[model samples]
Target: MAANKLYIGRKVRDLRQANRATQAQFAERLGISVSYLNQIENNQRPVSAGVLVALAEKFRIDLAELSGGEGDRLVSALSETLTDTLFDGYTPSLQELKLVTQNAPGFAHALIAAHRAYRHNSEQLASINDTLGRSLAAAETTPYEEVRDFFHFVDNYIGDLDMLAEALAAEIGIGDADPGPVLSGYLERHYGVRVARATQNDDLVRAYDPEARLLTLNPYLPAPTRHFQIALQIAQLHAEAVVDSVAAGAGFRTTEAYEICRIGLHNYFAGALLLPYRRFMAAAREVRHDLDLLAARFGASLEQVCHRLSTLQRPGQKGVPIFFARIDRAGNITKRHSATRLQFARFGAACPLWNAHQAFESPGRITRQLAETPDGARYLCLSMQVSRGGRGFRQPQQHYALALGCEVSYAENFIYADDMDLTNASAYDPIGISCRICERTQCASRAVPPLKGRLVIEHNMRRTIPYSIRPAGDAPQS
Candidate 1:
């Protein structure tokens, strides 16, 4: 199969930064003019075959990627939108696409907006056609989505609250020792609250009685979880003003969104308290981001470690830009944050081909995936099943898999990805955000075709997939 013209600006930029070569030096090595290199890095030009061979020979990059960078989000959306099979066999070249994005950005945005609206309207129409006089209301964003977007816009880091948590953690001397007792003592001394253990019969994980000045914790929770709960309580009580101010500044539309955002801020404070930025970052660098080692050294759970890793965007002393996600047995995404370019689907379960789905099959073992998305960006995903909050065999436990991944550009920073063959393009399992927005035309496990994709049907020619997707005016693939 012939490859289409790929816009791999981000990958090229990453490779150049990884090698620490100036543009002039890199251009000299690639045998291209500095201006041409700049255009390629900025995604204004398509890569030539000679340049591809130079990237392969000099940089060991197989030149497999699509357009991505810190450019306009509309460009990314428009690029993904154009992948619909309705476009027929004609694909705009990289230069032409760039021209559209640059010259008529509003037009590009209008096209993408139309595509998204079409998908939503199509769903509503299907529901309406199924029943007589059934009017489907206009879709509205949920409070959960509002809060998630709030966090996303903030880079999932509350600088003031994080600093406060770190300072309080230092004051309480949170080291390798048990933090539960220290945090409990701080609450007692400062707030005049009594910390006691809740009986096994108690259903609440934590209960605070203001009239009696008592804080009770369930005995069943693990030590790390107990400490986390204590830290969260402290964040609510001590950092109330800061968290409130941050939540207020986010200006969430709904009251429920504001409240949820407040809770999320408390979570950030709690995690920061458990793992101070500088201390945890030093340890993470020392261990090369080994999750187990970091967890043991910091007395944190694996899920907590993954969450903390995603928020390592501490301006100057930053760690690898990692993406973290958790999913239940039903494949519902419980938590997701991406400091990288890979975006999770806004609705529905993740793509089935993602590695997190298989993490449950092997309980304790770490599952790794060299996966590529429809945009041609690649990631190194690591996942493992985690269980928490169960009292007895009959009692229900919260079971989920936590996945930590970053682009292969930063793979060398992770110890788990040491043995991964980054140079092998065929090793990657093709995946997507979701089937509706996915651009793949030949996927055997595609739940549904691209939203507006045209399909070719034949009764006699059956293949791995029942129907093949093609451009509307193009002949069917044989």
Candidate 2:
């Protein structure tokens, strides 16, 4: 077994040397005896509380920063390294790795560097995997296939079908008072289907019956969920052309991913048609994007509200180009959509400092954080957790967080920004979008360092922070 390494002494000695002061001079500045300072630097004496306070007060540095509570930086780096395909089948539990990072950064850094090297080697070996002779075709099979085939069966365009649905609902006197029966009636009238109560078997929420040409929804689904399903079914059938047109615009290589995206886009159009963009934008502006109120007014879910927020970019009358993202506890980005220039990692996961993951700890509570990337782009993020299904303790359902944000300058428009002290930038907690897209140099939350830079760790002369680096993909290295 390897022996435990003490980093405190090395860190203390480095800090003292960087000031270019003698041991006696440093001791005098710190108001500690020369012998005591020497003992602390040599690891013979632990940094006492008084000395720690004195250092913080003298240097005007937060204790958290000095003690490296910013250890999340190391975790971010480790996660990026571990995501390498070398650990494709084997992964240390997140809790275990997090503990190591918090208590043993040097070991974590060494392990991460090794893993990254292994991943690079593995990539070289697997280079041929991309060109393997395989059919690589879309089957046009299964539920997703059925959905896509149905869209292709019709041209991909649904003009005013949403309006038609609304008109029919109004004709039938279906207001918000009783949305379920009204929506069910609207679906039956439009699609020749009847909503039937079905058991939650096979984890299916809704299924289409070919014989009756009927859509059967799970009885356990909430009212909002049911409405979304019904609306989605209508759009799938009536708005196929619109969905296909959008999917075609994407120019995807595989039909499978394209089809999935098509369904989602179609659902989005359905929601938009239900609560047209103009009215939705008006409501959002009025409420200052209060997601709960918007959700209620539009009869949409929080996820739906956030998703709609991203789509507000409609040519000339664009609303704020806020980005919306959803992530699980493991920090995997399950869903992400952005209207702004913010680039998200298409191949990897998001940065750990993103508020989307933090919302899980506080659940339902909103958190605000300001993030600056190495490139100096700043963002203000707002996040809160939301849960779906599992109301009666069957599995307690899956709960995760949703984060919405815009550039820092545009943040004040949000209601949550009202009481926030944005004047003191330091008071705002620091965060990052994802390391791959973020270029912030000094961020402790950075994972793989920016894809555009090479970090050079100077062991002989350590700074107050961990490592420094030159921007990657910049001018040729001189």
Candidate 3:
């Protein structure tokens, strides 16, 4: 099959129009001829790698957008354009289609659409045995919901594991050692299981053979990943009671989510046991939540430090009720949770104007903002970009923005608040959460109407913002 080609002409056009740039103006900014820019926008010429990189750098747009792999609208359009015979007889429900496009966008563009043409005329053959009208099991299940709920229980925090791993390593005099050897030694000493590599009949990176009391680990995983997996296994064994107690009565459609949740909870327990909540919280307060210092002291990753910061909200010893979230360049919410009353959109994307996205451009630099809505609710946000899981010369690193924020009134408690520039009444950046969950009436960043509002577009008497809306269930214009 031919490699899937991305035609981002429409996106280029949309962005150009949104920026109010004429073709000649855009061409000059791109350091290209107007005719060349026109050809690229019209799909007469493909965007070169050099030009694509330049556009990403100059316009502050994500490379994923140029490659056409990130946004829902673009993915959905690509899926529709690639539909073949297999999709002809039965039209898919919008939700199922969306799931495919969002989860396996590259696969859909490369395989599903190409296979459709070949399978167009083919049909499922009738079965020989007559089993007509037999009732079948329900086709839908909510495994994702179960997983989501499980993560929600922990508020998506996993700081405990990092502390435990560090302490354990220290005790064994392997605190600064390679993870694979350290984990292998720890597992052998604690579980009486030997770490071995199995080449046949196994599809997992790590698995425990209960019959032999042996733990099999894939040799290909990096040291950090290996250590994490082993620690997670130990956590499951030692923290079963803690996890089951928390997961009790949680509804699950499929056991898969529950199983994954169990593993994740075990990892969290491992970190907690290592750091111990009381000691870690004390250290965190003492350090003013300096992430690098915390990471070094606790032997945790920067991501782990930030994640742990959100879980300091235990009753009777409650810390700040800050909201935590991580986002990629295209504004995909990789993780999110809140201890406050602030709610996020369960579906759809977050607001693009948030400081989290801006952190990607100025990596390693902290960006602080105080945002308010038209309704007078205010938040103080602190965001920074961090990278994960890449090493050596050529490996690709995953970059994400980590943000912590709280209600405006509580902002003074944080270290960043000490800086007058960040706390200045007039200097805060104006931003919002995604439109669906935000109730701000005058936001210029709104991409869609708030969930139930009817758009009121009056061209002649426009507001400062491009869109206006009436409350849901109100009368429509004639």
How high is each candidate's TM-score?
A: 0.76, 0.61, 0.59
List ranges where model 3 is wrong by over 4 Å: 1-141, 153-186, 194-227, 241-248, 373-375, 390-396, 421-423, 459-466, 472-478
State how far residue 12 of model 3 sits from its true place (Å): 58
Best by TM-score: 1
- How high a TM-score does candidate 1 get? 0.76
Model 1 misplaced stretches (Cα beyond 4 Å): 1-139, 472-478
Candidate 3 lDDT over residue span 264-289, tens digit each: 56767655544446667778778776
lDDT of 2 by residue, 1-478 (tens): 5423332555567677887888898888889999988877766666776777887777565554345312334555576565444444445654555557645666975675466445544555566486456432222223443343233222222334434544544455543445567667767886788878776643568898867978887777777788778877767776677667767765454677687867666676566655566667778899988888887876777887886677664433557667677877777766665544344554367777666678988876788877664434577788899888644555457887898988767776688778767667675555555665464677666666555456677789876557786654345455
Q: For model 1, how does the per-residue alpha-carbon lDDT over 413-433 read when each residue is reduced to its tens digit? A: 888888879999999999988
Clashes of 1: 0
Q: How much is 345 displaced in model 3, in angstroms?
A: 1.7
| lDDT of candidate 1 at residue 368, scale 0 to 100 | 93
RMSD for each model, in Å, please? 7.6, 20.4, 22.9
Candidate 2 weakest ten by summed lDDT: 149-158
